[model samples]
Target: MSNRTGLARVLDDLGTTLIDLVRGDPARAGGIGGVVIDDPHDDQVLPPRALVLGVGVREPADVRARLDELGVLGAAGLVVRGPVVLTDEVAAAADRSGVALLGLAPGASWTQLAALLRSLLAEGEVTDSETLGGTPAGDLFALANAVASLISAPVTIEDRSSRVLAFSGRQEQADASRVQTILGRQVPARYSQLLEARGVFRRLYRSDQPVYIADLPDDDGGVCLPRVAVAVRAGDEVLGSIWAAVRAPLPADRELAFCDAAKLVALHLMRQRAGADVERRLRADLVSTAVEGGAGAAEAVRRLGLTDQECVVLVLALADSHVDDPAEHARLLAERQQVADAFAMHLTAVHPRAAAALVGDVAYAILPTESEDRALRIATDFRTRIGDRVVVGVGPVADGLTLARSKAGADLALRVLRAGRSQRAVARVSDVHSEGLLLELADLIAERGDTLTGPVARLIDYDLRHNGNLVETLSAWLDAFGDVAAASAAVFVHPNTFRYRLRRLAEVGELDLTDPDARFAAMLQLRLWRPV
Candidate 1:
C-alpha cells in the first residue's frame, strides 16, 4: 500500500460530478502526503503533494494569490466549495501551478471533506509504504503486484504508448487476453484494433472514472471477462492506464482503492519518465555526433557504450499529409516519440547495439550491421509490425569512420522515396537505380552546369525551340542501349524515321553516337536535365 495519492484518485473517491470544474492536470495532482488548511495570517509552505487550503477562509482570488506566492511550494491541488464561482484568474493560476482546482458538493462541509481526505490518506499508509528514489523500475513493478493483490485481480501497468511497464502476479482466473497482453508486454495489435474501434482510448483520456468494457471478444471466438481501467495521468496528459479484468464489477471500495493504485502508478511513471529523459539526452548527444561525424567521434561512440562495427543508419518518416493545424504538431510529436520508442524496442531484439530516436519527425536508428539483406528484412519486419504508414530509408553500411556517409546515404534514400511520389514502404541506397543516382548527381552539380553541358543542352534547346523530339529520341535510343529497333519502337516511330532523327539529333548536338561512354554520359544528362 503506497502512501502516494494522486489528484485524480482524490477526485475519483469524491466523484467528479459532485465537484464543479476548474483547470489543472489530474495526473499531476496526486501524491499527497497530507492536507493543509490555508490560513491567511499564517505564513508556512508545505512541500510537494500538499493539497493546501480548505474552503471558506480564503476567497478564490486570495487562494490564487497564495498559490502564486507559494510558487514551487504550491499544493498538489486546491479545494473549494461547489457554490464558489471560479474566475479566469484562479483558473489560470491553477494551470500555471500544475495543481488541480476542485470543488466539493454544493452543500458539502469543507472541514468534513478535509477530514475525509485525512482518513483516506491514513488508510492508504500501508506497512510497506514505499519511498521515492533508488530504483524506480523495480519499485513500480512491486507496486503493481501489490495493487493486484489489493483488488484481488490481475493488474498490468502500461506507458502512454500502451507498452506494458509492469504486471501483477497472474491470478487463477486470468483471461486469455490478459495472458496474451502480459506475454507480449503490450496489447496485441488485433485486440488494440478492436478497442480503438470501440472508443476505449477516447473514453479513457476523457474520464477519471473507471471505464468498464463488457465482453471483449477474442479472435478465436472466445469472449474475455469484463475489464475496468483508469488512466494514469500527469496533469492533463495521460501517462498510461492501469487495467484489471474480473468476472464481476469492482465494488465501490475496490474502485476507490484502484484509483489509489493509479496514483502510485503515476509516481513510479514520473520516476521512469525522469530516467528516460536522462537517457534520451545522452542518446541524443551520441546520435548527433554519430550522424554528423567529426574528430573524436570514436571517443563519443565509446562514451555512448557503442563498439566499433559496421552499421547502417535507418531513417523513418511518418505520414503527416493532413496535418494542417498548428495544434496538431504536439500530438504529432508525442506520436513520433511513441513510434521511436517502439522502433528502438523492436530493434533491440534483432541487434544488441541497435538504438533509435526521433530527431524531429524522422525516426533514426543506428543498427550494428552492414548487411543490406538484413537491413531490408528489418525494415520489412518493422513495417509489418509498426504499420504501413511508416516509410523506411536504409543507408549503405559504414564503419564508425564513415558514419557521416551512411547518414547521407540514408537521407538520399529518403529523398528518393519522397521524390518518387508513390506509396513505398522501404527504400534502400542499394535499391536506387542509375537514373535516380543520375538525377541526384545532376541536382548536386546543377549549380556548376557541368553535367548539363554542350551536346545535351544543345539537343534540349533545339527540341524546345522546334517542338521536335530529338532529345526524346536520343534518350530512348540511349535507354535502349543503342538498340535502334527497340529505341524506334519505344518512341512509337518507324526505324527509318528514328534513324533520320538520330542523324539530325547527333549533327545538331555535335556528338558521336558510337562511343559507349559518350552515350552513357548523354543518357545521364538526358535523365537529369529535364526542361524547366
Candidate 2:
C-alpha cells in the first residue's frame, strides 16, 4: 500500500469519483489527523490536520470565509459541494491559508462523502502491515480500481444485497443512475427492481460466465449504459459481484480477464471478512486486559494507544428486554455488534486515541481525558443519539495502573441502571453510588441465604396470613417521614384509616415507632426486601 496519508492520498483514491481538487497545493498539506463535519451551530474543537466538510456552504464568499477559518485552526483541507467556481478571491483565500480546497461531486450526499473519507482515513491507522496480492489486505478500493483497469471500464464491487462496497474512479463515464448508485452507496430501488424483474441477478449468480445487461430505461425517459456483471465466489458460496459499465461488449480476451478479476476479488473479500473478525477479537482481549488492570495492564494500555494520560472508562450495555425467542435473541446479538461498531467509530471521532470494544454483552471504551464531567456529557450525547434502548455508565478518571478501579466503578453504576433502580440512562458513579451500594448489600444477603427477621418481616407475615395492608401502611408512613396525612394520600386512604393500620402493625410486631434505631432497622429491611 502507498504511504500517502492526507490530501494527496485522498485525491489519488477518490478524485474523479467523489472529489475534485480546485485550488491550493496537495503537497503542502500534511498528514490528516481526523475527519470532521463542520457544524456552524455548535463550537467544535478541530484536531490538527483536520479535513473539514462544508456541508451547506455554497457561495464563493462563504467558501472563502470557511477556508480562512479552517486555516487558522490548522486544518489541512476544506471540501465544499462542487461545480465550484475558482474565482480569484477563493484562490487567494486558499493560498493565504495554505489549505487545499476540494469540491465534492454534485449529486453525492454529504453523508456518503463523510463515510468515504472516514474509511479512507482509517486505512492509514491500521498497524497490521500485511498485504494480499500486492495490495493492503482488505483494501477494496484498490481492488476495485485494479479490476477497472483490467476491464478498461469503470467498476464497482458490490455485496450480495447489491450495496456498493467500493467503486473505481472514472465513475463519470457511467450513466447518471450509476452516479446515483455510487452516491447512495446502493443501487436505487427502481434500478434493482428493474434488474430483478429481468432475472439479471438470477442469471449472473447461476454461472461463472459474465452476464451482459443491455441498456435499461430510466424514470426520466432515458437509458442507462450497458453493464457486464460476474458473481464473485469462494468455492460454492457466492460472496458478491463485480459490475462494469461498458460502452460496448468486451472482446474475448477482456472477458477472460474480467472473470479472472472476480476470482481475485473473492480472495480479497474472504480475507477482509476474516481480518475483521480477528481484529475485533484482538481488540476485545486488549480492552479486557487493560480494564482488569494488573501486571500486563500497562502494556495493554500502551498497545491500545492510550498511555501516560488520565483516562476514564465507559461501559455501555443494552437495557434488558427479557428476550427469550431464539430468532429474537440472534437479532439482539447482531444489534449489539452493530451498536459496538458505531460506538467505536463515535469515540474515534471524538478523540483519535480513544479505544472501544465489545466484551460479552457490554461495550467498554477507554477515553483519554481527565474530566469526568466531559465524559458524562459525551455519554449523555451518545445515549440520546442511540435512543433509550441503551444505557451508559461513566467512571472516574484514573491513571494507567488504576484503570481497573475506574472499570469497577463503571460496572457498579451500570449494574444499578440495569437493575431498574434508577430512571437515568446515563450516569456517573457519584450519581448512583447509594443505589449501587444497596444492590451490593442485597447481593450479600442473597448469597448468605439470610431471611428477613425485623419488624418489617413480621408485618409482611401478618399481611400474608390475614390479608392485611399493614406492611403497605408502614412503608408509606415511613416513606412520608411520619407525615400521617401525606402517607394517607400516598396509599389513597383516609388519614384515620391509615393511622389505625399503622398502629395495629406496631402492636402486632411489638415495634417502637418513636425510637430512631427501630425506624432505621425497619426502613433498611423494607428497602432490602423490596427495592424502590
Candidate 3:
C-alpha cells in the first residue's frame, strides 16, 4: 500500500472487526471463546492495534494459513478451542505459520473478546493523536516530541550531511569537543549517494506523504550507517531524513512516518541548498572579478587569503577530460597540506595550474622559495604521478610586487619552450635575454631561413640530403654533351657513345665547396639553436 494511506478511524473499531466472524457462525458460538489482542507497545503494526483473527472451536484446515495471510492483512491472534478438528500434521503446520493459537472456548464468548479489545484499543488512545506534520515544523515537532516520549531508544533528525537538526528526548547528541576536531572530522560524501534518495524526497515533499525503505543500505561500501532513513521533501527540494535503527526491520507504520520525516527534511534542504548555491556563485564571481587583467595572478592570491611571499610559479597543462571538474579541483586544493609537507625545506608555494590547485588540463602555481630546482621537482613529480602532459614554467624569485612580474616571466618561459623543445620546470623566462649574442645569431638564421623559404631552400635541403649525391644532375649534363669523344674524354667518360653527362659542381655539395663563410655561419647557427 502507498504510505499516503493514513488511517482515519480509531483502532478500537478496527479491533471490533475480529469479533464479527464468531457472531455469524453456527457450530462455533459456544465452541469459541473470547479473543485476545496484544498491545503493540510502540511496536508498529498495521491496522495498528493488535486484532484477533478467529476465536473458538476446531479451526478449519486453512484457518492458520488464512490467519497467516491475514497477518499480512494485519491480524494478530486466533482464539480456538483445545480440541481442533485439524489433523496432527495440520496443527503442527499452524504453529510454524506464526498464528497465535489460544484455547478460550470453555468460558469466554465473542462478545467478551470484542469488549476486551475495544477497551484496550480505547485505553491506548491510538485514535486521538494521528497528525503527521501537515508541512509544518510545529506539527513535526509535536509528533516528534510524542514519539520521543514513546521510544526508549535515542532518535535523531539529520540532514543528508549527517548534521543533526532536531533531536529530542534525553538522548545525548554526539559531543562536539570530544576527539572530534582534534583527530578527524566526520564529513559525509553525500554527493555520491544523494542521487538515490533525491527522487523520493522530491515526491514526498510535493505530496506531503511519507517515503519508506524496507531494505536500507544506502551505500554498500560500509562506511555509511546501514540504517533506513526516511526522507521528506518539499517540491523539488530535499531536506533530510528521519533515522530510526531500533527495530530489527522497520514496521509499515514507522516506515510511513519515516517517509513523512523525509518530506520534512526535503522541504528544508531545498530552500537551504538554493540559498547556499546562490552564495557560492556570488563568492565565485567575486573571487573571479577580484583577479583580472595583468594583476590577475596577484589579485587571485590576495583574494584567496593566502600569503604571497612564499609563492613560486609553476605552469602545467593536461591532455585529458579533467578541465573543470569541481570535486577534483577541491581535492587538489585539499592536497595543499601534503604539498606543504613535501616542500617543507625548500620554499613556500602558491600552487598554480589552471585551477587554484592546478589539477586541470592547464595550470601554474607560484612557489615562494628561491630554488627553481625544488619547485620544478615538485611540479614534475605531480605531473608524473598524475600522468598528464604538463609544462613547468618556473618564475624567478621576486619579492612581493615583483612576483607579479615573475608570473609574466613564467609566461615567457613557455614561449621559449614552444620555439624549440620542451624544458624542465627549473627553466624560467627571465633567464633569456633577447639581445644576447646567441639569440641574435638564431634570429639571423630564422630570418635567412624565411627568405630562402621556397625552392632555393628546398634545393639546399635536397643537396644536403642523400649524402650530397649529385650523380643524377651530373648524368643529365653528360647526356647534353652528346657523346663527343673530345668532351667525353675531358670528363673522363668511357665508351664510344659518351652518353653520360658530366657531374654538376653545384649538385656535388658533398665536397663542402671549401667556403669558409658558409661553414662559419653553419657552425654559429648550430651553436645558437637553443635561444634560451
Best by TM-score: 2
**What's the candidate order when arranged by decreasing lDDT?**
2, 1, 3
Which number leads on lDDT?
2
lDDT of 1: 0.72
lDDT of each: 0.72, 0.87, 0.41
**Candidate with more favorable, higher lDDT: 1 or 2:** 2
TM-score of every model versus the real structure: 0.56, 0.93, 0.37
Task: Give candidate 1 misplaced runs (Cα > 4 Å).
Answer: 1-138, 148-165, 173-231, 237-259, 316-342, 370-373, 380-397, 409-418, 421-440, 449-453, 507-521
Runs of candidate 2 with Cα error greater than 4 angstroms are 40-48, 59-62, 85-89, 124-129
lDDT of 2 by residue, 1-532 (tens): 2345678878877867778899988878868877888876755767788889998989999999999999899999999999898889999999999989999988888887888877777666554566667777677788888889988899999999998888898888888888888888899998899999999999999999899998798668878899999999999999999999998898899999999989888988898788779989999999999999887999999898778888999999998645999999999899888888888888776776788999999999998888999899988888788888789999999987789999998999999999999989999989998899899999999999999997877888888889888888888999999999999999999999998988898999889999999999898888888832
lDDT of 2: 0.87
On TM-score, the stronger of 1 and 2 is 2
Runs of candidate 3 with Cα error greater than 4 angstroms are: 1-226, 230-244, 248-301, 306-310, 320-361, 389-391, 412-420, 423-532
Q: Give the C-alpha miss distance for residue 447 in model 3, angstroms.
A: 12
Task: Summarize candidate 3's per-residue lDDT along 36-57 as a digit string, tens digits.
Answer: 3332231222332134434423
Model 2 C-alpha RMSD to native: 2.5
